[model samples]
Target: MLDDFMTRATLAGIGVAFAAAPLGSFVVWRRMAYFGDATAHAAILGVALALALELSIFAGAMAVALAMALTVSALSGRGYAMDTLLGVLAHSALAFGLVAVSFLSGIRIDLMAYLFGDILAVSRGDLGVIWSGAALVVGLIGWRWSRLLTSTLSPDMAHAAGINPRHEQLILTLALAITVAVAIKVVGVLLIAAMLIVPAAAARPLARTPEAMALIAAGIGAASALVGLRAAYVLDTPAGPSIVCVAATAFALTGLYSVARKAR
Candidate 1:
């Protein structure tokens, strides 16, 4: 029974890793880590809405993330700094979510679990949602990889080449929303952004191309999930944080190696 439980947890973790790694590569490349954090912080509001309306957590998170992305995209055109806007929205939404959760009197919800995640509690149905969302995200990214690369490398160049940077941005934002929704369940709102950034960061120094970076990020993420799960099991620690620690460790090691190579 214990073995079966661990197997399911591990599988779920792997799914999260696969989904997070590729998307995280984009996040790192675009310097959208703060945007990711903003979207993820808003997920708590989605959780509250889900509980209030009896909707699925995944659906609620996706809805909120999509709304947040749209809001940010629209606001980006208003001449305000993007980081400032993201900071306001992220913290404000998190505060509001906390207040909303406090309003529910009867049920005792573990806010920490939602904030930091409880991956061991993931159900088979949740796994289905994670995989389906992951497939959609990966397929969309793959289909537009060239365009995305063009836009990321140089918006002016992409525009000169007739690719619509705005449209690509929208597509990437949508994909990010889906990713945040799917990942929130695995790593929770507070830590979801880490899952999206850490593995990609770790892979950056080792990659020579955008595609190589993404693939390596995915491999690192998958390995982190497995290693993190093992650590959690042995140390009786929380799964999500343990997984993040592994990713961070990898990032540190990669950074050191890069520095050494540069010095040589």
Candidate 2:
């Protein structure tokens, strides 16, 4: 299996899931799903820029995602609903990126690959990038765990405890950007936010606390990666979306169990 392309794909998916779990919990708790989606969508623009400039796709994605996150944060109270703002920015970026990609001459760009991911095509170097980026996300979250939770609970309470909620939000923004960058190879831009949100949602019914939710989400995410990859191999489907299908299946099952438990 070590010599197989599927092995690298599995490892890459697993790395992305573990990093996304905790970040996804915060996205769910803070109601930043739209923000996450907007940023992920903006990655298409990053891909265009990377190809144009001959730079690393990861670096380009991280830079663009960070810019998108910061732009959203700066526009938070500017007399517009967050959803409305994100919707405009997200779709606009995607449209422009697609147009830009169409203009690239002399290169056969497989737009579907970037949009939906080419996980089975991941190489050893890509695995190194995925795992390294995953480690960075985990370490950053662990360092700011308490502060972030406190801020999520209440900005006023965070202030009373000398924690700036905005700063914590920015920290999460940074982490989110990094996640999108690394995850581009594994799940691509279109499904990146799903990777962030689905496992956390699935884990919620089984968890009793914030910490438990994070750990459970990670386990759910890892399971989705493993199961989804095997299923994709067996069924001849797209690996990235298959992983999401597994996570969505988990979410459906957990939701049903929660409802049944409540009825009983």
Candidate 3:
């Protein structure tokens, strides 16, 4: 099974979807889309760091993504507007990462693979890492579901319930870093946030409850992965973007459904 690239790619996509679904829901609820983008973009810096230090790319990506997320979380509410701060950090990290990559003299790295993913080249070890990260994320989110929900709904309410909103936010930050690390091989840095948001956005119209939204988003994400891989193979298109395109299409269709339902 692992010998087949398509099978591996399919499993990788499903694994990422599982991890992203719950975290994506929290991101949407907290209005943290920019936050997600910033963290993902920082993965490039991780790639550079990995190459320079001869460490695992996954380790480098996760470390930098964690740092980026923590920085954003810390800097938030320190006077700068959220959007402005994220915009500055996101682009700066990406630019610095690109510069860092250019400094790697002897390495013959393919930037496009990191920037846009190389899911079809995933190995059995990569699949193992993806599934492990996915399970950890899902377990972490599930364990903190109620508290996270309460904090997301209202910080004050969460404090009253003896839950620390900051702690919950930290948990999410950790989860986001893990997701970025594992998903870099599936959708790459440029489109990771789309995979995180679009499926959740698409699921919104069909779900009446938060739990339902997470499940539906997971389904949509997994479906997009499978469909996108087939489309890419048939059309000779890039696999990562094709997956994101399917998800974007789902978002558009669901948006239309929402508007129609509201009118009728």
Candidate 4:
């Protein structure tokens, strides 16, 4: 009946995979992997604020992630290089977050869990949060798929179509924030970027079109979540990192296959 914590954990993992995979494809297409990482790293700071103010961690994380994403979007047009800006923001947020977390007096915190996740510890309430957040991200992506793709292919093309490229970017930013909020429970901040990138990258060689890539990436992500969960159970390893490791391995194999096919 799969009606236990393990079931909840598995469901949470799958939900996150579903939401993150398609968005990951856009991230790969636009080369925004670093931006995703920066927003995720800001989650640590959110955790600190949440604990300090006695708020929900999810809410805090979401707020911080949105703020970070918006800030980047606003600044990206103002003479700042994208990679450099994200690098500065990502490391600074993480450093400040660690410092802030250290100041919470007499409270025992599982820092490792926030960094690497503890999926097995997820509860029914967490499952609700995960699925809800995932649904929002997926729905938003599906609703704006065409415009988003247009903007991604070329901002001028999007403008000519009367679609505001900036608006599409904001939609992606919103989706990224929600994904980060939900994913923290399943994969933690350290591995969220991996979840957002690896599956999409792995699916690249096998996919002939953008839509095909997104679908295949989602499938790969879901399979990795399930398979990695089982591997962690048997091997007694960290579930979040184990999943990322499996995804990386899959990416490498696909890359090799592509190379082999081209050589033939």
* Model 1 lDDT tens row, 179-242: 8888886788999899899999999999998889988998888889899999999999999999
> TM-score for model 3?
0.99
Give the candidate order by descending TM-score: 3, 2, 4, 1
- Which residue pairs come into collision in candidate 1? none
Per-model CA lDDT versus the true structure: 0.88, 0.94, 0.96, 0.93
Please identify model 2 stretches exceeding 4 Å from their true place: none
Q: List the residue pairs that clash in candidate 3.
A: none
lDDT of 1 at 62: 86
Error of 3 at 222 (Å): 0.1
Q: lDDT at 55 for candidate 2?
A: 91
Report the lDDT tens digits of candidate 2 across residue range 1-264: 657998888899999998999999999999899999999999999999999999998999999999999999999899999899999999998898899899888877889989999999999988888999999999999999999999999999999999999999999999999999999988999999999999999999999999999999999999999999999989999999999999999999999999999999
The Cα error of candidate 4 at residue 142, in Å, is: 0.2
> How well does model 1 score by local distance difference test?
0.88
The TM-score that candidate 4 achieves is 0.97
Worst window of 10 by summed lDDT in candidate 2: 1-10
Task: Give one digit per residue, the lDDT tens place, for model 3 in 1-27.
Answer: 788999999999999999999999999
Clashing pairs in 2: none
Best by lDDT: 3
